[model samples]
Target chain A: MEFSKPIKISRRHVLKMGVMGSAALSLGIFRSQLVKSKTGSAAGSVAAQKTEQIGFMYDQQKCVACRVCQAACKATNNWEEGTEWRRVLTSDKSKAYLSISCNHCEKPACVEVCPVGAYTKREKDGIVIHDAEKCIGCKYCMYACPYHAPQFSDDTGRISKCHFCYERQDNGEDPACVANCPTNALTYGKLAELREAQGGVDQLEGLPNPELTKPSWVIIPKKE
Target chain B: MHWHWMIIIYLFLGGLGAGAYLTSFAAEKGWLGRNSSLRRTGYFIAAPIVAIGTVLLVFDLGQGLTKPWLLIGLLANLSSVMTWGVYILAAFIIVGLLKGYFTLTNKSAPNILTLSGAVLALATGTYTGLLLAVIKAVPFWATWIMPVLFVASALSTGLSLTALLAPLVEKKSFCEGREGRAHILLIVVELIIVAAFVGIMISGVNGPVAKESVALVISGVYALVFWGYFIGLGLLFPLVVYIYRYQRSKVPVIQYVSESPSATSDLAANEQKGHHSYLTIVSDISVIIGGFALRALVILAAIPVWDGITIL
Candidate 1:
């Protein structure tokens, strides 16, 4: 069950927004897009450009609950000693491990709640990026995100979270966690393709329903 | 998880300030009929109180500030709940100041201006609730009735403050009379709304999460606070006091004559005879303290039950 609501653009609204953007900029507003589309478009298009959903696929059965992804993320990102962007959550019985990072959601609450417009879903790709410079460290994003994606960075006193490894992808590499997954349980590809390849879903037994933000990822449940 | 005592404090103060403005506005609109003291007290207290709340929010956000010159994150985004809050709060403060200044100077405030300020106060109260209600994460806060509950609570707390403070500035009659009953009515409504919020959460699709959250208040670690501090002292005691004192005349029948010196002087003379019962003072104090406890209780108990984040 997808928890995130998808954005719909009738082509007219986008054009109207484009016109408004240019008009404002010409008037010396020098402003970035302060408001993002709530009904986030299914395609990862930011502006006029069309983009595909580069999604993550996680398999529960072929896995051991390893902290390698967390380690790799820290090492690769050079995050502070005690700071972590991704975390491992387990059930009370420890029957399974659910690794959580930023969902890079379609209608991200972090972006919506950030007072300074610090979070942006890159138009070229749909990567939900957090610009460190613009962050006011209110932790409102932490409160708003249902999945608790944003982690408070004590070092900087600002909230930090995963950005789908935008830098790595730009450098023609996979995310630190997915690349370092020794079990080969983590997969990354086009979202539509991954859905057909595996019976991927957005909801699970104990996790927050992903239908709220329509997380741009899929998960394979354990075999019955 | 971080303990957001600051947020809780802000919530209480915001409700108090906004609720005062609303109740006062209601009096000014003639909804309460001739309680000028209510209007004056509300106008006087709202600006500074809300200003303090806004400042608290700023410092809370200032946690990550590296440079003092950043001017405290004034940047606004329409999509942000905080951003909307900043605007609404600013509007409230501005209009409140104008209305207050004009009224004090004996300049008549147009109905439009007064109406606008009241509307803004209403927004301020509702937005405070919306901030939490929109957080789909914490199941305890994710309820439809949150906005309504907060508004009612805000009114109750706000009116309670006005009653307590107005006695000191003006005559005790306003606080001791029908306005006191109105304050009680607001509290009663707030209690009912809170029950409805919990009831809906437990009975609806959110039953599982809501039940666990409710347990924290009913039988969990915070049970003592929820029952003792909030429900018992804040709500029940005040209610009993209110019922006992005002059982005879449900509606205060004194005609408000601001220009009638004879009536005003008579009230001042009557004031020396202890016009407001001690229990009324105790009830107002209970409501105020109870209101603060109520915020703290729910917020403290509101730790989301972490079931699991299923990636598979």
Candidate 2:
């Protein structure tokens, strides 16, 4: 049997497709704007005004891998043995060291995947915190986090991670890690200001994609 | 990532129990032919198997035993896959027990009840896979194929468990009839799906972690279990046994077309009595072993995306 020719598209068909595509694109844009405006109304505006998304700023150019941040985090949280809330992973290919803890993400996976609502991102500051009292310790959050931020402790049978030193921040003090960093590599501030100050480069070598959780972090890449 | 053997056994049992319930439901609905022993055995074992798995799951949790009330928190997050699993598992266990009860009491269960239970069984089966797939951190488990492969494995393993228990349930030869054919088809499909799963992941689309995961299973640490136990014993062994039995016990075409219905049935019964022998039992056990190995290997070989990176 002979094969049939492929279906042909004429000028009229092309014009029709173009018109339909343009209409759909315009409708989508209009709908997005409408939704945005609706969500930005009085109550939303007020909520927005009351909140500032907190973020971390790290300068890889200055970190000496001394792990003072890690030590400070451990001391601040008083975490059990075998739990490192903040870890410094050195790059194999380079001398760069990434001192990381929970990014306190805008799209925090821990908040989304914690079955018992153990983890919550505060509306006022976007600081993600874990309530150990509510944790069932299923550890789904550990697997959900692209950054592997949530630490599971067999000793406590619960999950915990960087709380961004919320208590200290509320008391008008820098986080223990930030305050303890001798090189002034670690800092904290409103995410927008941090991004603006750090040139908006949140991702570094050995770090996960910033887009995954929209992590409230900014990093200054190490000089090669 | 510390899921270990407890989660492996839990996932296997959950899928197996769901699969067995489905297999029995299919039999009861006459989709796999009338085998009262098969139906009863499936109903009897499904709920208890799932219940045991649930217990293991709970026990694996940090405070599952000391503060069991904390389990109520599992229902708090509608977005969490584990929350969905809690609901599915609860409904499945309830309906599963009810079905078993009706079967034991010799009462005909309402079609609605059986149908919903079957649907729940399916959900339970699919949910086990979906639970892992939804985790974005583990690139290997993030694919849609995980659920498909899991469903296939669950069905095959469920059928294997039912077949393994059928003879003991009735103290007769577990006749390798239509069930054998179905088993062969399921195994083949499972093999294909496994291949596709490995192929897609290794093709480098999912990410480097996914590729590393495939490497771990294919030729890395888990390669031994993946190839030796899962492929050789679980899939191929049962497949060969079923195919051999099928070839050995082909009823003559003339006998099937016989005018005397009683004679034909008598011959069929006698043939079935000799077919599913002790060899079939061993094959079924191999399948169960393979199922457990499959779950363990998948869990162990999953290299999380953020394990560490070499490049800037």
Candidate 3:
């Protein structure tokens, strides 16, 4: 199918113009840097030291489908009654329950789709959080999330979902959902350590829902 | 199934419809007299409609309202349509207000201002359809033809509104010559686009999403809105009216000269033509209302409920 000329022009022209404009602006900065170097002064400061890394690890086999985590999420966040930031989905036929929340991916779709920069991923920990104040409640994030994790609150009109308990983690405590899990199914630790401990899912086990968004969780096969 | 999406869709369609009509109206009226009484009325009416529509969109976003600044400040994602839409609509409101102000002051408006506003209005009017079309996941909305159909709907609705309001604001009588004919032609085009869009949607239902969307639009809850309003009243009825008028206008005149062979006949040709023009204006109003209804229905029906569906 033949595409319109205007589409091609707009796409190419906008990009070219943007690059040219940036190059000119950066040239000015580069000349100023050279002047600063002549004066024997550093143009920039050193990067900050790395902080503690925070993330989640879910043991699917240990999850009894009791959903205490879901309850704990609501209680901790004081979210509206019907809103569930953390949802527990169980396949009765397979006797497996999966607790799904925001994966806080290296690249988050919610952050990408938000019209207003209401959604953000922390560079330090890769934790995605919503700033309700900036939220226009467009709900584009809901469609973008492969996990279907984000939930819109009717009372607030803004998108509300799990923040992985950033506050609790800041205080050196596990997330409410992970802390309250009875069977130790949920774990919170450094992302690298969790990856090393569980070794990622290699094959389908106990009705694994492959369609689930690349969750940060590790699934251990349930023992018969 | 959230009502907020419905509100967002309504605001988008209404603002675009109002903005496009105002732009076309201003363009038709010379730039010098852009703030004339007719233009003033159009802008005055349109500004509030768009402003109120935007407010409705904000209200739909919900309460916590923490990061309202994200829209303007940090969260402007150029890649996403929603982000662009927010910025475009925001620009529309700003430029529209400035245009209104300049008109009130009886000053010559800037060409760039009017042109940019028109372009933004056009983008705002059409992007909603494109937003849905880009989503490969939703079969019903994934079509190259959707954006063109949206543009047609926008023009149809915009023209309909101007036609409906013209008699009240402009001194021109409803039943007259050129303007009436243009209105009729626009409605005809709008009807054709809607037909093509629906045709494509129904014919391509190989996937589950496609089948579900088609079912929803044709036989499900959307049927009343699509068929009852968009198809039945919006397109079909307007086509019948335009055709009937065209036929009457084209009919060969059968004049019978009785006693005096070459006597001057005062048949009042202009007066009869005026009557048909008035009918055309009424038809334009019907088509515009129907077009608006179609846009509203399409938006509400297109969004899927992402409750249990796992994203791969």
Answer with 1 or 2, whichever has the higher TM-score. 2
Model 3's chain A TM-score stands at 0.70
lDDT of 1 by residue, B69-165 (tens): 3323434466766767877887788777777766665667678878888888888888888887777767788877887887887888888787677
The clash count of every prediction, one per candidate, is 11, 0, 17
lDDT per residue as tens, model 2, B1-312 = 568888999899989999999889877876665443477778888889999999999988987887887776676666777877887887788778778867876768779879998899889888889989987788899899888888888888998899778777766545544677778899999999999999999899888889999998989888889999999999998999988866654554365674453344334545557335778889999999998998998899877787643434
CAPRI quality of model 1: acceptable
Reproduced native contacts, each prediction: 0.42, 0.58, 0.36
Docking quality tier of model 2: acceptable
Give the residue spans of candidate 2 off by over 4 A: A1-51, A198-200, B172-176, B254-269, B308-312
Task: Give the interface RMSD of candidate 1.
Answer: 4.6
Error of 3 at B114 (Å): 3.1
lDDT of 3 at A66: 91
lDDT winner between 1 and 3, please give it.
1
Residues B77-158 of candidate 3 have per-residue lDDT tens digits of 5567775665566566666666655555555568786667677677767676676665543456667777777776766666
Measured by TM-score, how close is model 3 to the native structure?
A: 0.71
lDDT of candidates 1 onward, in order: 0.71, 0.80, 0.60
